[model samples]
Target chain A: MNEADVIAALRALATHPAARGLRDDAAVIDVPLGRRLVATHDVLVEGVHYTPACPAGDVAWKLVATNLSDLAAMGATPLGMLLGLTLAREAVWTADFIAGLGRVAALWDCPLLGGDTVSGPAVLGLTALGAAAAPLSRMGARVGDELWLSGTVGDAGLGLRMALGEMAVEGVLLKRYRRPVPRLGLGAALAGVASAAMDVSDGLLIDAARLGEASGVGVAIELDAVPLSDAVRALLPAGEAGVLAAAASGDDYELLFTAAPAAAGAVRAAGAAGKVAVTRIGRVLAGAGLRLRGADGPVALPARLGFEHGRGCNAG
Target chain B: MNEADVIAALRALATHPAARGLRDDAAVIDVPLGRRLVATHDVLVEGVHYTPACPAGDVAWKLVATNLSDLAAMGATPLGMLLGLTLAREAVWTADFIAGLGRVAALWDCPLLGGDTVSGPAVLGLTALGAAAAPLSRMGARVGDELWLSGTVGDAGLGLRMALGEMAVEGVLLKRYRRPVPRLGLGAALAGVASAAMDVSDGLLIDAARLGEASGVGVAIELDAVPLSDAVRALLPAGEAGVLAAAASGDDYELLFTAAPAAAGAVRAAGAAGKVAVTRIGRVLAGAGLRLRGADGPVALPARLGFEHGRGCNAG
Candidate 1:
């Protein structure tokens, strides 16, 4: 389909009143009173972010999921999103992408607002808006806080391996890579509770280091304590080094956060309320860098912490 | 520069407190009570929306300006914006692009919010947020409303010709093409006065037709009444056909609005207050579609209305 035809197809999916029937130059929304608005933008490219063989529907899902993960990290409720889609010359791909976008938007209750569409290499950008009574920030972590993580960390990495044909394409691991879920419920429950928080996109170690840097503290993560799915443990190498490798793999999309030791009970309760698994990974220290520890003691940090753009590391 | 270096450079430009030093996953801002929020997103790709030869700085400027123009059409005040930049492998171009983005953000009082950047084919996407007490809509026009335009309609078209080497590269017309100004002040002044409003990014005739379609009315435009810059008039072909061509050209970034005839004085006063020239070029009729008239009789419509994406028509 051409740009107009694709847009016409998308118009059917924009059911929210704020979308203005996808006719206006922009979308108009009445933000709720007394709530602080949180905004985030994320871009996903074709070859760099996802493999060419990946389904367009999966690409669309990951694009929206990753962006919503940002809002989740902020402990915000999803409101709406604008999509900037640069499509390749594939009509069927465009249709599948829009269908996937609509599906995720409806599932997350983040209605589609308005955005521009263009023709070019496949690069999709989403700007998500949310509302929070008290949003969490990475800078809010304290020196003595306990670090926590939700969900398995390395399934997505194993899924990536399976996608690369290095392993069997099992449903669980492959799903982790193709359709990772954003932890919005747990994040919202953590509002005003967690000292600092962020979702792990570029691997646990790198993202943890970022949280530490933002909070002006240091993180010491126990490698063995890092959560891993049975599929990942079965498929990947065993031991602390394997755990560390999993920690350094990207596209986890799980929440890595810190809270005071006193709030551990509250954190556990919030996790229970959200029906998500919670694990204590490590503690915040009074320093400036990320430290990795194993059962034997302090382990040497890896040469590469996690994925960095242009360094052959994919983002979500 | 790599992605980290580019993000660090952009950090210096993100002086807004809401940006959280560009460290957090998202930016948090409090929208004032009782005001509606307006948002728009646009993407500019290399060799599509703009020529590869265009300065990265100008590309950045036009990207922000065009999104802001959408807000302007809604009579909104600029709040802040998030930028999703997919960069080509050029450090100097990245630096210049960020500099241009920072300049325009400061000039328009729109702060730089947090966004994601990746390395890929250069595609720039911006999502602008704004606030309006009474946002205008294109569905408000009534029969007999006068269609008014702010600023000259054909200058940007002439400027595009200059950029394309079809004419002399004069500063005035070239600047119009490179850095078309958003009529924010005039739009804000017409908040409650304009029956219907939109910006002319596409050709005036095509955009007017869209306004007519949106408002459920027809537009009757007088070819001679369309405003043209002195430079455009001198350099381009002359007389009725020339005016028609100019009206059919795109990227004007001028406001096209309609108001009751009784509000003409108010419209003039608003234009004067905003320091923008206002001219009446058409009227809304109780029918559908657009009608163009010349001095002698009715004029035939052009085969092509205006620029549409993927049709080899450049937007920026």
Candidate 2:
């Protein structure tokens, strides 16, 4: 996420026992006294994620943000972070990359901590540490909670399009992809407000369906209300194309939440306090399927949705 | 370091406010008020560090150990870690790679936490999180602090030669390269006792010179007393080839440390408790230089030495 949006979005996280203000070396956390910890790891490779043409500094910044986004999806507060950097062993770029990371990490208050350095292969790997308070897992959303999204959506996806010259947009959407603002604050704020929550790294509609499957429920979204930034709007030919693209494109890094109807006000208030926009997109239902209520009535959803680990998008 | 040594080493870390043990999903750290954090990162690419034919699992295990090894040298307790994994999307050995890492992480007690997973290339990136103790640095050693090594040295260096089939030795030397032991416990144990301490990933003599430069001191090493494992000795050619090779080769992962003479007993005790050997390899002296005393008077040290990030090493 862009530094400003990330700062703004993270600022919404109220002080809690585990994660306080995003202002220390690492997020302090308290876990249950005796349970074997469950930890899973993933890594992103450069050129595979973004082109080398992208700024090295942003590459460093985005790497840290991506890892933190995972922790947010898992309902964990960051404890600390480590980085594994592989560059060409060229003095100039490596130094710049580290300096950029140092600056961004300082802004977020997450210290670099420690990691290994090696030559060969140009890649950057980051490991983020986070603790769960009754982890609000991808498998926990209920059948009746209303579906909600914190802040805008599809900005990063569109931003990437603009970066690649595939689409042209103005304002935030382009900025979103180049730099995503991770909703760490919104994630922590959702702890007591939502039944289940996850960050939208994959496309929202697709991720929503996955969440539904995980929770053994179905989801229905009202296309009219899906939050789309002006940047996403600028990319399409002004109608269904824009809406559909926004719905299926990923990398928003927003907190998608399912909460009881009664808690809607609180969720909105929480989102607003951090100046993040909250939108009611859909509802979780009893059956096991995903439905979209577009302007043309019910329509079949795209099966190839969201980002898969090894597989590229079906659209590509 | 391999899974076993990593477990043994991490288990030996003294009780701390941050790390609970090597068994949690994420390390629970207690950060003090005020003061920001400082962090660094690096990643090792396969074929660059070891052959692709190397056991994939051991390679995975070593990745975490190497990163954690850095934290140990920095005097930072285990905080959290991240992994950036890249593998051929269809590698037959991918599952084995992940499983080996899971096993070692389970033993080390650090959780997998969060990271990015990408397709393309075949490499492993690991980042280790650690709580920083301010004024904690490589530059902490001073003039006159007796230099010490946590355990018997050169086995890994010797192990490398054996791995390359260049040396026809047997016993621990092979395992040495395949499974270097990270001196986590000894390094952590030296936290208070050592004025300056570092894990010897590079050879003893080279790393010693680095410590001296960082601490603004000179160094004098006694060739006769450098500890050598029985496993290493059994495989070495008669004379000083093994000793000389061990002194210059990297990948030892031992803790090379310096302390005031009064702390010698404690340093030795720490090593004993960790089950690693310790020896009076050298002493920090005035001015800036390194001197090695052998039977033939002060022998000329290697003109250029150690593993530089980009420069090719005989071990690599």
Candidate 3:
């Protein structure tokens, strides 16, 4: 089997009319009238993004989820996705990836519009297109807004540790690492409610810091308030160190956003509508940089904030 | 020095307001109100798409042009571009690529919307977005329509050979190989007038065959009517073989389309407006395959139609 086989599988999955049955080189989408188009692209390499132990389907899921997560951050409803796949000559792997792609194509209701494929190393490229009338920007956070997170922090990072055998794992940590759920519904719910929002791909603390920098405000995170899953709480290291581990670890794919304090009830309502838990972990402050607080007093910042790709996650 | 530096450089290039200063994870574009959004993606590996002899800037240009070429085929005017660049740990190469990208970003008037980059092999990915009120498709050709081609074919394929030291060469053939222009204006003009439209990225004959297949029609090419550049004409292999060679080469990025006989004048006028030469080289027929002819009689099909990436270019 070759790339043609892979494309045939994708074409079968691309059911939207905009896909043009994958016959046309480009996908033609009727932009919803008066809506702003939201677009994001992300690249994931094999070893860097996933371990060899990770399943092929999971890799496919992560690729789709991670990109849509960007759209989710912008409060955009996903319209379509385009993939640029560079694969090694492995047919079974390609077949499995296609199957995994089909699963997410339905799960998100995001059509596989069309894309280009070539033979090379395992570097995958994905672009997600979404639309929103009142899109939220990271630069829109206000000075007195409260910071919220959609899910518990550091689960995926812990899952990564489990996948790498650095820790003996029980529960679905590995699954969490492999198949992240993009908060599409929650994002759409937060569209007009949130002051600013972004997906937490690089870790909670670092992303919050970025939000603060973008909005020209300061961030103060209460370590006690950083929620941890039961499984993670049980398996974590020590007290302050463990909390830092949770907040600083990346790959969470949670929605980290800011909204006015008076809008807390509305924010919670939006969260309930999306069926995702919303936690207020911090608040926006005047000035710059990040501050951490424990019950005793202000805690010291971690030397390393999060798992940055060493460059601009912002562009992604 | 790192990814932040790269993002900072890209932020400088992305002047479009939709880019949101590259601070957000995704771009928010106002999709021209009512136009259909056209999107296409292409992937180019170092050895597969270019050689060491090809300049870094040319690769960047080719990446942008090839993706835009797909939009050109759909008769869509370009809007913006997103790049996914995976580079080896060479700063100079990265800087050069960014420079080249900036050049084409201005040359095409397509803003650097935003994209993701990572450290890996020398693989490049690009997505070009455009909009059209009445986009043409490969499947829209009708029988009796005259086939039109913009610019000479086989120049880029020959340029590739020269770049690889397979043949001695002079003139702008190498430039043609490095950076073929996308027919943006011509595609826009042909949007409603042409029955069907597509770009010839593969050899003209194979692409014509594809057009025929997609539209459920037959394509008949008159070999003698095929155009060649003066430089290529002087240096072509020989006889019917040279003409076949010219038509069977790929990477021309020329428009190969179909229009009604009555629209010939309009098509020529569109070509004049686009500042690109247009040639009538064939006709759409009632059957379902491709046929070729010379001054004397029929010409046999070549073993290979064009430079296919050995998989589903149809997806592209």
Candidate 4:
């Protein structure tokens, strides 16, 4: 099909009520009066974010997922998504990409609004709009708050290694890398239960440190208590070194949140409500900066905490 | 300084209250109870939409303005903007780009809500959010509605030729190409005045055709009535051919709208309130498509309407 046909295909998939059948230049949306609008944008570049060899469908999934993760971090429910897809000259790629977008959008229950598509090297940009009565932020943690993680860290990191053929052992790790589930349900459940919250996309340690800095408190993550997937445990060491690698790896789209000790039962109840595993991995302290503690004593921090663009980390 | 420093500099410029210091992952906004949110996104590729020779600041301005233009077309008041800037590996380029964004954002009164930036060939994507209780759409024109235009057409198109060192004549054309003023005020004023509305972005003739098609009405334009600046009169031939050329040229960020005969005075009043030059170019008639009416009689339509992606048009 031609570019117009491709665009028509996309319009077919993006059937939001306010999108006006993708005929208008813009979309008009109405949020409920009581809820505040939460908006986030993220860009995914082809060689930098995902390998060229990566399937187009997976790339589409990841592009939307990453932005939704930001919304989830704020404990917001997604309202709609707008996309700016700059694609290379390949018809098959575009067709596959649309298919992927359709599947993932349906899966996540996120309806696509309208956006621009043009000829360029692959760089997918998306803006996700969400709504929450009391949207959470990074600066809400207090001293004595217990830090919790929704899922095992570094599974996606290991998935990346597998995708690159650097590591062979696999048990749903590559899928983790390709299809990240934004912690929307867990985040919504943790809203009133948790004091502070954020998604762990750029590795646990770095995100935790950012949370600590935002709240003007110190963070102390226990290396021994850091949860690991069964696949990660089979592949890496059992203790401090293994958890360190996990903590420093990016692409874990899980909730890393904090709640008061008095709300421990409520936290577990919220976790049960969201149907995601929650583990206590750290605590908020009175001092400043991040402190890593082993079973014995304070452990030395790594040179790089997690992935920042152009840093030592290159997962894709 | 470094990349983080560049980001910090951008953080200084994008100071929307909803942005929360650009420290959080998302921006949370509370809209007025009655307003419906209007959202639009557009992407501009470096070598395609612009040139490497083009100043990064101008690129930044054009990027934000184009998206804001879409918002203006809907009779919406801008709420905020989110940017996704993909820059080449040059600190100077990034610094200049951010400066341009700051200037344009401030000029438009559209505050920046934070977004992502990464290393790639420059592909600037921006989302502009606006609010209007009863937003205008492209389908409201009736049979007897008069078509009106704001400002002059084709100045920016001529400006493109000048920027490419093709044409010799000068005066505000280059500025028009470099800095497009979105018809935000006029659009805001036209909220209840215009029956149908849209910005003339991809050329006057093509955009008129689109409006006609959307409203299921035929548009008959008197080429002689299309407004032209004195600078354009000095450079181009008089009457039909020159006006046709201007009509088929793109990059005019003017508003093209329709108003019923009964509301003519109201439309003029709205234009006066918005402080923009408004001209009655044509009227909506029965049937479909666009018809060009000259001083003598109806003129033949052009083979190609206007700039579509991958067409003969390549301004940069």
RMSD each, Å: 1.6, 8.1, 2.5, 1.4
After superposing all C-alphas onto the true structure, candidate 3 shows an RMSD in angstroms of 2.5
Per-residue lDDT tens digits of candidate 3, residues B79-107? 89888977664676678888999999899
Please name the candidate that would achieve the greatest lDDT relative to the true structure.
1
Error of 2 at A47 (Å): 3.2
> Model 3, residue A87: what's the lDDT?
67
- Give lDDT tens digits, candidate 4, residues B1-316: 4778778987898777898888887998878889999999998887788888888888888898888889889999899899887767477878888888888888888989878877776788899999998999998889999999999987888998988889874758988988888989889999999999998878899999999999999998989899998877767788787898888888889999999988889888888877899999999999999999998999999987777743334445
Give all TM-scores, in the order shown.
0.97, 0.78, 0.97, 0.98
What's the ranking of the predictions by TM-score, best on top? Answer: 4, 1, 3, 2
User: Whose TM-score is greatest here?
Assistant: 4
Q: For each candidate, what's the DockQ?
A: 0.77, 0.25, 0.65, 0.70
* Ranking of predictions according to DockQ: 1, 4, 3, 2
Least accurate 10 contiguous residues by lDDT in model 1 chain B: B307-316
In model 4, which residue pairs have backbone atoms overlapping below 3 Å?
none
lDDT of 2 by residue, B1-316 (tens): 3333333343444133233343222233433333122233446566677676777777877777776676567555565555556655344466566667777766666554444445656666665555444313456778778888766777777767777778785656777677665666666567677787777776787788777876778989888778888776766664455676667777877877788899989988878766778888788889997888876777778755566533345333
Q: Residue B270 deviation, candidate 3, in Å? A: 0.7
**Candidate 2 chain B: worst-modelled 10 consecutive residues by lDDT:** B30-39
Span of 10 residues, lowest total lDDT, candidate 4 chain A: A307-316
Which window of 10 residues has the lowest lDDT sum in candidate 4 chain B? B307-316
Q: For model 3, how does the per-residue alpha-carbon lDDT over A1-316 read when each residue is reduced to its tens digit?
A: 5767877888899889999998886999987887889999999877667655567788889999999999899999999999888767367888988898989889998999989878777788999999998888888888899999998887877887777777887558877777889998999999889999999988888899999999999989989998889878888885778899988888889999999999999999989988999999989999998999998989999898997764322211
